[model samples]
Each structure stands twice: as C-alpha cells, then as structure tokens.
Target: MLSLLLVALLAGSGAIGVAAANDAEREDKPGGAATSQGPRNRSAFSNPSGNLSFARQLDFKLGDGVFRKLWVAAPSSTRSSDGLGPLFNARACQACHLKDGRGRPPGPEEQPSSLLFALARPDGSPDPVYGKQLQTFAIQGFAAEASVQISHKPRVITLADGLRVTLQQPQYELRELAYGPIDPTTTLSPRIAPPMIGVGLLELIPEADILARADPDDKDGDGIRGRAHMVASPTNNGRQMLGRFGWKANTASIADQSATAFLNDMGLSTPLFRDGFGDCTAAQSACRAAPDGADDDGMEVPQKLFDLTVFYARNLAVPAREGIGAPAVRRGQKLFSDIGCAACHVPRQVTGASEELPELANQVIWPYTDLLLHDMGDELADPGTPGDSRDGRLWRTPPLWGLGLTRRVNDHDFLLHDGRADGVLQAILWHGGEAAKARDRVIALRKVDRDALLAFLESL
Candidate 1:
C-alpha cells in the first residue's frame, strides 16, 4: 500500500506537477533541522522480501491438479459468471482501481463518472440505488439501478481571535432508490480503492504486536491511547475480525476484501462469493433475478488469482530511504517521536510465517501502523454510527509509509474517512480523538518546526 502511494505521488506531477520543495528554504527552517541520529534505524515499511517489480510470474501463478490448482489459475471473465452481480459497479476489478490498484478522485476536468464513491442509503434501508456502491454502469438491457449527485455543505471554523473561515464539504447524493428512504439517522462514509501492496504481510503481523501497543485508557496521561476495531466478517460466517481494509476499517483479509471488490465494486465473483447480493434490496427483483452466485467460468480459479494478488500486495517493496538525508527531515523525525505521533503510528514490525509463501516468511516490514483502532473524538466522529468494541469515531491508525504519494496515485490529496484533507499537512490538522495531543503539538510548533515535521512525514 505504501509503495503504491509513493509511486502515485512521485509520478503525479506528470498529469499535474509536483510542487518542488525548496531545499534551501527547508534547510533554513528552525524546526526542520538535521540531527545525528546516526543512520537511523531501518524503516520497516520497505518490503523485506526480494524484488517486487511487475512480472508475468506475478501476473500468473497456475497451480497443480484441477481442484487444488485453483491456486495457480486466473479467474477468467465469463459471459455469464458465478460471482458477478445483478447489481454492481464495474465489469472488472481493474476498472476503478486501474491495474488492480489506485484511482484518481473524482473532480473538476475529470470524467463525471470516471470516479465513484460516496454511496447513498435512503431514509431507513441499507441498500443503494446502483446497488450499494453508487454504481455508474449496468448490465446489457438493464437500466442503471440509480445515479449519484454531489452537493456542498459549509461549516465555519473559528480562530482564537474570533476569525472564522468556512470549510466546505462535498456532500453525497443518491439519485434513486428501489426501496424507501434511508433513516434520518443514517450516516455515510465514502471509500475508494487503496493499494493492494503488502497486505498479506500486514495480515501476517502477529496479533500480539498489535495488543502490546494498545493503551486505550491513556494510562500514561499522554492523552493518546489506541484500540482495535473488529468488524463482522461479511463472509457472513459469524466470525468477527480485526478490520484490515477499507476507510471504515471494515474488511478482514485480502481474500474477503478481494471477494467484496469482485462482488460490489465490479460485477465479478469467485467461489468465495457466489452471488452479487451485497447491495441488492429485497424490493429489487431484477437485481436479485440471478441464482445465488453469478458465472462459473473461473469459479474454481479464484484460489490461484487470489493467492498471487495476495503475494503481490503482501510482498510489494517499500522504497529504501537513504536515511532522512536532509537535516530538516531528521529533526522532523525526532519531533515525530517527541510529540507521540509514533504512539499510534508505531514505527516498525516483523512479518510472521506465511505458511502459504516461503518468500515472505519472517520478514521485517516498517508500515508505521499498529493495525489497531482508536477514538479520534467528536471532531472526526461519524455521528449516529456506533463503532465495534470501540466508538464510532475510531479508525485504524493508517500506515504512513507512502502517504506522501497520495497526489500521484489518486490525483488528489483527499484524506481521512471521506477524503477530508488534501495533503498530509491538512490531514494532520484534522487529527483528533486519541491523537489530539499530538495534533495540538503540531499546531504549536513554529514555522520551521512544523515544516520539519511535515518534511518527516513527506520523507516517509
């Protein structure tokens, strides 16, 4: 995931242009200083496995025997499929996430339907018009389930001196629903495709590594405590698990997450997800007209496709940093530690046995997150929605590895639950809940210090 973001951000300027950092100006900043931390500890974010460039071996990994060999074959797109949906967003997984990857946020100059997220739920029901994902396309001969519209709501931010600035939010609109309106209390959170890199390793990180860092009560009075958020498996298997994917932190594993993407995002399916009934409402007969599952061209092929996808995402490497080379970046790293940003965005971790792949076993990865959940307080809470074992506002501390690459990958720097910020700087400004202390410290820093800290994040 971090590596994907880094590529996107680094290559972003091509479509637009990266605002070059003024090295001299950065060096002059007081807080963005250099320190002799002596070749800082190796960042675990980098892929500890070997090279991970794109390759046919990565693209294909067919297995043995017709049954177990499902582990090596690709799930072919069939005319009438097993895991597809009567209601779905795209025809292929590569559509929204281009290359089984990241996407550009919808915005000015971008195709109206090129980007999709911000789904709408009517007054009381959980279903969405274009089936739950606010879809833009439809199967041949079928009318699109619904369309999406956007509006803006502005709120005032008051300064210490009473100066106020308006913050405008791009509101989501659901054009049509097959059933009733969403409950007045219903809330929404927009999500998009995140990188598929390193997820396997992330899942492999021992649960103890996660719990050892939990301090939900803020025992030290640092006011920054973290917890874990476990959501229902949705495989509907009655198993609740630590959420490892999605902005809402809802998915449990690459397999489940991948199956969801296949069913919800694209109208595809695998043996795992037999049908596309996810967003289908009981009232939508057409959407549910198919059998329990979709096509079967590759129903048996999921094992292989999923494993490689797992291998790719799990072992994709993090770019090696030459050690916060600049003085300002170094100071920013220290400030990051001193201020407790590291508390939740913990710096490092080692991967466990892959049992599946020998190559990824016992690897050390620096992902910058403990993969736990935390309450971000009211300022960031999505009211009306209660969370898991934690509160509604809690979110997994996202890994910071390739955060700097947001602009490149998605073409915009929207961050948080609904793309609330445009850059790391703005995202930091929006932090609350357990990390409020760290957020306050960031605001209190002088221009130089703030820049240094940001430099540190950028350097990540």
Candidate 2:
C-alpha cells in the first residue's frame, strides 16, 4: 500500500522533475514490486528482477540450469542429472512450464505432454495401483503406470448479447493399465501447468495482508466468500499453513512446490523427498526396485541444486503492462471494479520484509489476485478432492499480472486449470458460485463495455 502511495505522491508532484516520471514508470512495471521486463518479446517471461543484485543474478542463472536440465535413468555417468523416471510425467521442469509460461492441454491430433492426471479413490487417498499422478512414461526396463486418452465434448453458451461461445468439456479414459485394472470409483483431475511469473512476490506477501482480505462467512453478505486454504507444510513437519501455490492452493511455500514438482513431475528425488522411486507405491514393485542415481550427497537432486532451482522459480519477473494509458484500457479498468471482479482479484499488495531475498522485501505490487480459494461451483469443479479445505468445486484465485503476455510467451491463449477456456471472455463466462454475479454482470454489459473490459484485461 505504501508503494502505491509513493507512486501517487510522485504523480502529484509534477515539479519533482523527470526522475519522478521514471520512478512512476518503474512502479508501473507489472512484475509488481519486482517487475522485470526484458526485450519485450517471446522471451519476456524469462528474467530475474531488474532490481536484483549482480551477485543474485549469477544465482538466478545457476537455478535456470537446473530448471532446464534433462534427467536420465540411473546407472549412467551423469549421476547429477540421472534418476529420471521409474514413473513420471516429464523429464525436466521446463517440459511442463515451457519458457516459464503456461502449458496447454494436448490438441486432438497431439499426444498429451504438460497436462497430468491426478488420481484418487473415494476417500481422497491415492489409487492403490497408480499412486497419486498417472505416469505415462517410465525409464528403461520399467512399466509406466498407465496410458491416458482424452476426448472433448463440445458445448455452447450464449451471452446476453447473442454471442454464442463454444466450450470444451474434456473426458479422460485410462488405458493400458500397467498395474491391472483401477478401482471403478477412482476419480481424476487435470492440472495444467500455470505460468511462473511473480510467484516469488506472491510468496513474500504477508500472511496478515492476505488474511485481511478473507471474508470466510461473507460477514458483509456481498455474496462473495473467500477463504485461505490451509495445507500441511512439508517443510515444517506437517504444520498447517495458508496454502499459496497450486491450483487448489494445496502447498504453502515455494520450497514445497518446487520439491513436489521435482518428485511428482520428473520422478527425481530431493532432500525433502528422499524417494528415488517417485510416486511409486509399494505395490509397484518393479518401479520401486528400479536403480536409483543417488549421488554422494544421497539424493538424486542434492540440496544445493534443489535450492538453486527454487531460487530460479521464485524470481521469474512479471511482464510489464502494455497500453495502460489507452482510453479503452482505462474504461475497462473501471468496469473491472464495477462488475465486482476486483473483490477477489485485489489489485495492490505490499510485501513484508524478507531476510532471505531482500530484493523482494518492502515493495508495492499489483498482481490482481487475492491468493485465496473460492468455490467456483459445479461446472468448474474437478472430479476429485484436491487437498484439505479443497474439494471438487474450489480453486485459488490465479494472479493476472502477466496474463496478457500469455500468447506471446506460450504461443497459445489457452487459460484456466484445464486449458479449456479459449480466451479471457470464455474464462469469465465459465465462472460460477462466488463469481456467478460477476459473470452475470459481464453478460449484461453492452458490447462496447465488454470490449473495454477485455481491453483492460489485455493491458495487464
């Protein structure tokens, strides 16, 4: 909040000279508090904070190596990068989060890559056979958990102005079960990779600041109820903390998220997760017995490499806003608030001091997210429970800072958890439950107003 006030003060003092304008412009950088825009092109998503120290920049590059390094099966000379999959979805972190942007669901003629199937039984336990995530790939001499086939059922929704939008409803079928037939009642959820920009700033946002936005019981009775997701902290010995990352806000810290990704996405073990046989349950004997590439440090990914990767993920800058001063974008910004979108997508937050990464401390940012979970109703709900305080119908409000650059960075505009929504409007049309009123407001808007609203989102 103080950061915003400083920007306002500088704007008010026109006599302060050119330096004031430059500082105001810097404040407008979208990575917010830590905005770093580089070259303004397809590679815009990849950069450390512009304000980062020279020493820290070297660390960022080191982490980038680990993020993009390809892993292999054990018993290879490349022990540092070995221990890929007994069962896994990808061989590297960059596979899903390409260029640190979002991952899309497989197209009709393409095989699935970045998308993963999270499997669970009726009582929220991992499937007895496939474990937690279905792995379609395995190392040499190992059997993958299963093969997944996806088909889409087309559906249409008409807005108030007679605009008909077609939406895809994905249907998944598990085939070629490596461990025999799965339980008939097993549930599945699709988790598409989210863009990795300004997450470090999100991590630094004070818990008190986030909690202050929560209206768990809708005490004001505005028909909007948002609550923080409490999850077991893997780094803190399972102590409950506000969940900040993941589709359901199922993880508390960036460390947990990075560690989990290494193990779950790549089947590579880290100090936090010592298992080289990632996601392979006891029943999957062949997978568990697969050779492990534990280095002298005793984990597939040593502590230093693991920490470096997390550092890389934590500092990916948010792309700068484009055309913020345009008339349509200005109008859209107002309508965004008028339609109640800002209630959940709060525009401004200030980070508390951070001893670990001082660059992230004490800055104003506009990430346009509350980082809280809200029930999105039936249409958006997944088939399975996500975690504690999370069910089929709830999801964390994703930040909108770098949203406009999604097309440039990932080369596709697919959005939402499953990459089902073709663009921003469709994503809004799909909103329900707490966002039902916002959806109705957008539907009733005049075409001009709707266009302006979209323009405002694009400016982000």
Candidate 3:
C-alpha cells in the first residue's frame, strides 16, 4: 500500500515521466524558466527571474530601489521619501524582509520591526482604539501605540527512537499602550514577514487549478480538507477572487499585498489603501490630525512608484534547487510524498498565461503549496473572533520553495506564521488538525528516515 501511494505521488508530481532523467533535471530548477541560477549566498533571494528580458532589467532595479527606500515624517525637504508614520512598524519594506528573505522574531531587548501584531474584533473589524494592527513606532512627539515582547515556554516531545525534540511555545504581550486600553474582545494575531520569492509566479497560477485541489468537505475521507479563501479583489472592481497571499490568505494579489504593506507597515499611502494615517483610529484624533506626505495627487506612494515596487515584488526569482539528486535527498523526497506531506504541499504547479509578464506565464513551478487554508489545530490557533466561523484556526499553507536558504539569507531559521518554530522539523511537529497524521508519521519515522525527510525539504 505504501509503495502504491509512493508511485501515485511520483506520477502526480511528474517524476515518472517517459524521460526520467530529464524530469529529474527539471526538478532541480523548481521555478522552471524563472529560477535563478545563483551566487548561492546571502544575495540568492535578491535576483530577478532568470528569463526576465534585459530591457526590463532596469525596471526591476528601480523597483528594488523603491522597496528599499526609507520613509520619514511629513513636511521634509525630501518630498519623495516623507510620509512615514503617526504610528507604524517599519520605515521600508527591506527593514522587515531584509535581503528579500524571512523575518525573524526580535530578541528579548530588541524592538520588533518585521514581526508585527494584527488586531481584529470578533466581527472582522479593527480594534476600536489601536486599529487593525499594533504599531510600535510613531513620529516624533507622538506616542507609539504599544511595545511588544515575546517569551517562550519550552515543550519537549519524544519521538519513536526516544529522541526528544524541544519546541518553544511563543507568548506575546503588549506593553506601553499609547492610546488607551484595548477592548477585551479583540484578538491578536502575530505575523512574521514571509519570504518574497516567486510571488508573481504564485499570482499567475490559474484559479481553477488551485480550486481543483480543494477538498473543503473532505469527500474522499482523507482527513485533509483544504479550502479556497475567497476575497474581494481590490483592483478588480470588487470582484471576488481567490486569496493566495498572507498568513490567513486574506489578500488576493501581489499588487494588493504590496499596497497593504506600504500602508500598514510603513504608514505610507498607496493607491489601494488611501488613508495617510495608517492604522490610526478615529478615536485617536491626534494621529488623524498629523501631517501627511501626500503629493499633489493626494497620495504618498504615487502610481508610477507603486507600479515599479509591485513589479519588483512580482519579478523576484526563486533560486534553483541545490543537491537535488543526492542519495539522501532522493530518499527524503520519496518519504515526503509517502508520508502525506504532499497532500497539502502539492509540489508542482504550472502558471497560467500572462501577456503582461510573458516570462512567468505557462511555466512549471514547484512552490510546494496548495495555496489553500487548513485547520492547523488548537496549538497554533490565534485568539478566536466571536462572529468568525474559522475561529482563527485556519491558516494558509506557506510555500516551501525557499525552505533551505533561511539561515544564509536571514542568519536565522525562524519558521511558521509566528516564528515560533526554530527549524523545519519543529515546524512540521507543530502541524495538527488535517496535518496531524502526517506529523505523527514524521514523529514515528526512524532517525535516518526523518533525517532523509528533512534533507528532501532542504533540497527544495
């Protein structure tokens, strides 16, 4: 039965093609034509798509400039860079996503820039006082919303071979409240900045293909029920579209994600989120009265600059896989599929057509995510919202394309939505609900097989 399942998975992953050698070679380039054959260092995630035209190279560079550009308080002589914050988290996109990689949780004494807290009431409305997110930074003369502190409680799990793995259960506390006391019913969700590789390609994945894999009712009785997160398209005139980005799969497109980050993280106005006083509530009159950095068009980030930034985000390339054909990696790969990890982290997806970005269109990519929401069980659940049916238990399956390079790119191996897991193994162990069986299988694996499984993930 296990052998049959392995064969079925291999066939589904296109690993059993007529030209097996050719297929193996193709797997090494997980991003297809867009994969960056790399310098293989800290700058690995910073490259443009491999197939991007030379003519468009300058545009990508300009977009990088916009992403790394720092913001300041309004009324400054640097007209283009002003409009920072009444209350915000980071000054630039790069501040959180340093080197275009993952964001780490801040140390005990450090103030958070990349790890942010999102606040929502039971009915999916912003907190009445602190607004949608908690901002730790404020412009001069303004009180910041709050100070965030994280502490961990140790949890040790003994595996089948009696190998004990310790996991840190993170605890978040808000201190130094600036505005007022938060409503007791508000739910706080901590989010780490996810890596920004192959996002454009993810956007190009056909909605039909994604929905085709969703088993919301679990009709097959596999206990893995992935559901599509339907959200209103911010740019498509309120058209409901598949939600593919963010920890909760709340945002629908790369453009929307970029615009949202500009507003919430940096307190800069974008075309999508037009409010210059980002995250400041109506109750906070002082924040609302603060001066903004809007230009003649009444926007902080103008259309041209916003377009460049979004383009840069969309074009960031996925690095090519390293050491894919090694004996351990091959074993690990087979084990990964056999253990049911691929049920949600479906390995292969072909991007749909895109005339505007031809290089990304119709390419086979290995993002290792079904891009659907799943019940992650109680351990990882955020505080429940009263009227929300999901009750904060469902989380989007983040892509695993750049799983191996976390240490090189960010100098840390913080994983998962809250950066609670210290490594790949810990992240997997934390899985529950639909992934509970897979997690148990991993725990039951012999040490060698477990190591092989991790090796396969790292080769991704």
> Of the candidates shown, which would achieve the greatest lDDT relative to the real structure?
3
TM per candidate:
0.73, 0.93, 0.95
Model 3 per-residue lDDT at 65: 98
Report the lDDT tens digits of candidate 1 across residue range 1-460.
8755664453221111121132223222111111111221323222223432235333423211111211111123442233344455654444554432344446642322325553333332343333345555555444555555656677664533344445546666656643445444445545555544356667777766666767778787876666665677755584887776765566777677776666565555465765545456566666566443323443522555655544444444444344355888867867887787877776656666755655545654556677777788776765333234324577777776656544544456666665556677667767787778888777677778877888878775
Candidate 2, superposed: residue stretches over 4 Å from native:
1-27
lDDT of 3 at 347: 80
RMSD of 2: 4.1
Candidate structures ordered by TM-score, highest first: 3, 2, 1
* Deviating ranges (above 4 Å) for candidate 1: 1-84, 98-104, 108-125, 128-133, 153-167, 178-180, 183-185, 231-240, 276-278, 290-301, 383-390
| Count of clashing pairs, candidate 2 | 0
Cα lDDT listed for each candidate: 0.54, 0.83, 0.87
- lDDT by residue (1-460, candidate 2, tens digit) is 8766776654332112232234435436755547784766788888898788899999999999999999998989887888998788898888999899999998766555689878887788888887888888888787777777888898898877899889887788887888888878788889899999898999998988788778889999998788888889988998998899999898999999998988888888898999988899888888888898888877999999999998998899887776776788777877887798988887766778989988888877778888999989898989996456537888899998878888988999999999988999989988999999999999899899999999989877
Order of quality (lDDT): 3, 2, 1
Candidate 1: worst 10 consecutive residues by lDDT?
64-73
- How many steric clashes between backbone atoms does each model show? 35, 0, 0
